[model samples]
Every structure is written in C-alpha cells, then in structure tokens.
Target chain A: MNEAEIIQKLQQGNEQAFRHLVENYQKRVVNTCYGLVQNTEDAEDIAQDVFVEVFRSIGSFRADAKLSTWLYRIAVNRSLNHIRDNKKRKWFQSFEDAVKEKKAGLLHYATENPGTELENLQRANILHEAISSLPENQRTAFTLNKYEELSYKEIAEIMDVSVASVESLIHRAKT
Target chain B: MNCNTLHTKMIFFLEGELPEREMEEIKIHLESCTDCAAFAEEMKKTLAVLETDKTPQLNPFFYTRVKARLEKQAEEKVVTQRIPVFARILQPAIFSVLLLAGIYTGIKIGQPAKINSDQSVYTENEMIPYLNEMEAEAIENFLME
Candidate 1:
C-alpha cells in the first residue's frame, strides 16, 4: 500500500498497517539510533519508542515530508534525548561503576584479525566517546553521514537545514 | 594553503570532496608538511575505526515487543480517560466537604474570641452607662427642639 493508505490505516488503529511500518523501518531506525548511541540494546529500545510515538501521534503528522524522513527525525531526536537523560542518570554512579556499565553495554564484534578484537573494541569506544563529545548538531550530522551513510542532501532534509549547514556541521565534527 | 586551512580541509581532502585543483594543492602541502601529514593520517585512522563498529542485528521479536508496549499504553490511556470521569463526580463532593470543613473550623476558631470581645464591649458600655444615657437624652432633646 501507499504511504497515505498506511497513514490512514494507522490512524484507524489497524494492526496490519502498524506491523508493516515496524517491519519496514525498524532496521533503519534501530541502526540510526545505534549510530548515535553506540549501544545495541539502547538503540533498539529507543527505536521502539520512536515507533510507539509515531503510532500514537500519527494524526499530528502532516505528510509534508516522507514518512521515513519524519521517522529519522524522531529517531535522531529520541536518541539525543536518551543520551542526555543517560548523562544525568549516570551522574549519581561511581566512576568505576559507570566505566563497567559502559564496557558491559558494548558487544563483541567478529573481526577479520581475531586477536585484535579487544583492541578494536577499545578503538570503537574511543571513537564513540569522541563523537559523543561533539555538540549535538555536529554529532547528529556526523553520525548520519558516517554511520547511516546518508548523503549530505539527505542529512539536510532530515535535519531541516541547508546543505551548507550540514557540510559545515560535519566538517566541524571531524575537526 | 597554510596548515590551519589544511587541518580544516583534511577530512574533506581525504574524502575526495575538494575540487581537483584544491586537491592537488592539498596533496602538495601534505607531501611537504610533516605535521599536516601526520594529522591527516590520524584523522584517517579515526574515520576508519567507524567501520569496525558494526551495526547490531535487531531482535527478531522487536515488533512483538512494540506491540506489547502499545497495548500497555492503550490500556493505561483507557484507565487514564476513565479516571477523570470518576474524578469529575468525586471532585466536587470532596471539594464541598473540604469547603464545609474549612468554614466550620473558621467559625469554631473565631466564635470564642468573638464572644469574649463582645462581652468586653458590653462590659465597657455598662461601665459608662450613665454617660451614654445622658448623651442619648441630650440628642433626643435636641431633635425635639
């Protein structure tokens, strides 16, 4: 079915249409969140929230942009919010405990060089921390460009900014 | 280009985003500048680390979990909507009871003080009764005149 039909069905509370949306955009939303948050479980949780919000507030959607664009916007916003919330919540924990919690949240990836797995994980954490340190817009633009492999134009559309602004954001993020 | 300009352009240069002329210029600069070359290499490695971090495969039952959450939310919303209706009925009754209690407390608290003050006034008037009586008689006479 077309976007309009799905939107109408969702507004009417159709289970099948809702399933279709979740099935189609779940990976993109999850991965987009994972790119920003750099944690599998948190990304999936945030993605579920994104879908839940979309379903609950489908009436507010104007369809001025593609549903996927709207979904990406929500995913980015929710992921950033999750990060902010985590920072506040983590403030109460001891440093050692926070470090342990971070390490535990990281998953093991299969590496081409087997012994380099730990090294790679450390590097990944370092890179994730570096990206996380960036300001919100730069981080979002950089993550969208690097992690999601979105073109500059696409990132601009999702961020509701000019392409030049996105280019500047990514450039600043790298520097 | 200067090293500062090169640092800004380093990622774009590595990504092949610069124009051909600018790319050549940056290449020449990188070839000659040891500091710029090292910085570019480090930046390149950092960007490459992004590839090692694989996107995790989402759980198979993600939709199922979302559906459960939505169901819970819907149930909560139903409960929430129903609450206000009952509250609408109960609220005024509770408010009225509180209102009556407040007024009763105020009257109870003030009644003794009010009676004492009124008794003091009566006593003071009794103490000066003859003066008040003469003043009243004088006014009556003046009116009659």
Candidate 2:
C-alpha cells in the first residue's frame, strides 16, 4: 500500500499496518539515531522508542509534514536525550582512564563504525568527537547533511528553522 | 574571485550545485591558491571519513526484535488501558481521603482548644509556642498599661 493507505490503516489500529511501518522505517530510524548517539546499543534503544512513539501518536499526526521528516525529528530527539543522559554518567572519569577507554574503543573500531577503513577509522573517531562537541543544532544539521545526505532545505524543515539558518549552521559546523 | 568568495562556494562546488562557469573558476583558483587547495583536500578527506561512518547494520533479526517489542507494548497498552475499577477509583479516593485528613487536622488544630488554648487558639504547629507568645503579649500589654 501507499503511504496514505498505510497511514489510514495505522490510524485504524491495524496490526499489519504497524508491522509494515516498523519494517519500512526500522533501518533508517536506527541509522539516524546511531549517527547522533554513536553507540549501537543506545541507537537501537532510541530507534525502538521512536517507533513506539510514532505508533502511539500516529493518530495525532496532521500530515502537515512528510512522515519521514517527523520520524527524523523523533529519532534525533531521542538520540540527543540518550547522549545527554550518558553525559553525566561519564562526567567523573579520570584523564588516564579516559585515554585508556579511548584506546579500548579504538581497538574495536571495526565494530564501532562498520565499513570504515582500519586506518581511517581513527580519523573518523576524531571527527565524530569534534562533531559531538558541536552545539546540538549544529551537530544535528551536520549529521543530517553529511550522514543522511539531506539538503539544507529538508534539514531546515525538520529543524523548524529557515534555510539560511541551516546554511549558517552547516557552515559553522564545517568551520 | 577572492579567497573568501571561493571558500563560501567550496561546499556548493563540492556538492556539485555550482554552475559550470563558477565551478571552473573555483577549480582554477584552487590550482593557484595552496591554502584553498589544502582546505579543499581536508574537506574531501573529512567527507571520505564521514562517508564510511554510517551506522552499523543490526543483525538480521532486527525486525523480529521490533515486532516483539511492539507486541509487548501493545499488550501493555491494553493492560493499562483497561484500568481496573479499583485502580481507577483508588487514586482519587486516596487523595481525597488524605486531603480530608489534612483539613480535619487543620480545623482541629485551629479550634479554640478548650483543654488547651480555651478560646484564642491560634493555628500553630504546637500549642505551647502560641500559648507562650500569647502569655508574653498579655504581660507586655499589662506592663504598658
């Protein structure tokens, strides 16, 4: 069925529609969440939360925006929340322990970002750390632009900001 | 064009959004400007690294896991939606009972304590402090008189 048909069935509380929704969106949602959280397990958890939230609130969706954009908003929000929650947990670590932890994580780089070259994975990690330190809006804009390959216009729509603002955000992020 | 103009358009050039003339101009500019060339190269490297930085694919049973969670959640929603009569009524019942207890206590405390304040009972935590203050006030007034 088309998206409209699927949405109608979903609104009607059809289990099949729900299953179809999950099947259709599970990967993209997980990937988007993973892009923000940088942890596979946490991304999966957030993906689950996003789908559940979409399912519960599908009735309220006004169709004013594309479904995927709405889903992106949810995925990004959940991933950011997970990062913020874990922030405090990692706040008390000693510098040596943190370095050791970084080395340990680097040891598992292949699993951390699958499909990355072994040599380039360290560079990727550094870039990810830089991106992580960006303010939330910049990070979101950059991730959506680079990872999802979204246009600045689409990202502006997702973020409820102007296109010029998205351009500025991405420019600042890149700099 | 100047370096700032070239830098501003670098992202668009890389994205292939710039027109042929502008792209050619930037390419010609990049050839002569070592700084812009290095910046472009760095941007390309960053893009390459980020290109491979995709989220790792989950195991094949990902759909199964999601479906299971949905089913479990659906079951939970149903269970919670049912809202047993006792459970539904019990919350407000408990709240009202506590509220009534508070009001009763307040009234009892504020009442003219016949066994205590006799008539000028003030609403204080304990009767002793109010009685002491009232007695002191009376003594002061008498001394003033």
- In the range B1-145, model 2's lDDT, one tens digit per residue, is 9999888778678878779999999999999999999988876786677665664665577767767787898898899989988989999999999999999999999998455564335545445534577666887889888
Model 2, residue B139: distance off in Å is: 69
Candidate 1 docking category?
A: acceptable
DockQ of each: 0.34, 0.26
Q: What ranges in model 2 sit over 4 Å off?
A: A93-97, A112-118, B1-43, B74-145
**Tens digits of lDDT, candidate 1, A6-97:** 99999998989999999999988998898888777789899999999999899889978989899999999999999899889899889999
iRMS per model, in Å, is: 2.0, 2.8
Q: For model 1, how does the per-residue alpha-carbon lDDT over B1-145 read when each residue is reduced to its tens digit? A: 8999898888789999889999999999989999999988877877777775545666899999999999999899898788776787899999999999999999898875446888788888785434577666887889889
**Count of backbone clashes, every candidate in sequence:** 0, 0
Model 1 misplaced regions, further than 4 Å: A107-116, B1-8, B25-42, B52-54, B82-145
Worst 10 residues of 1 chain A by lDDT: A105-114
Clashing pairs in 2: none
Task: State the TM-score of candidate 2 restricted to chain B.
Answer: 0.64
Fnat of candidates, each listed: 0.60, 0.47
Best by DockQ: 1
Candidate 2 chain B: worst-modelled 10 consecutive residues by lDDT: B118-127
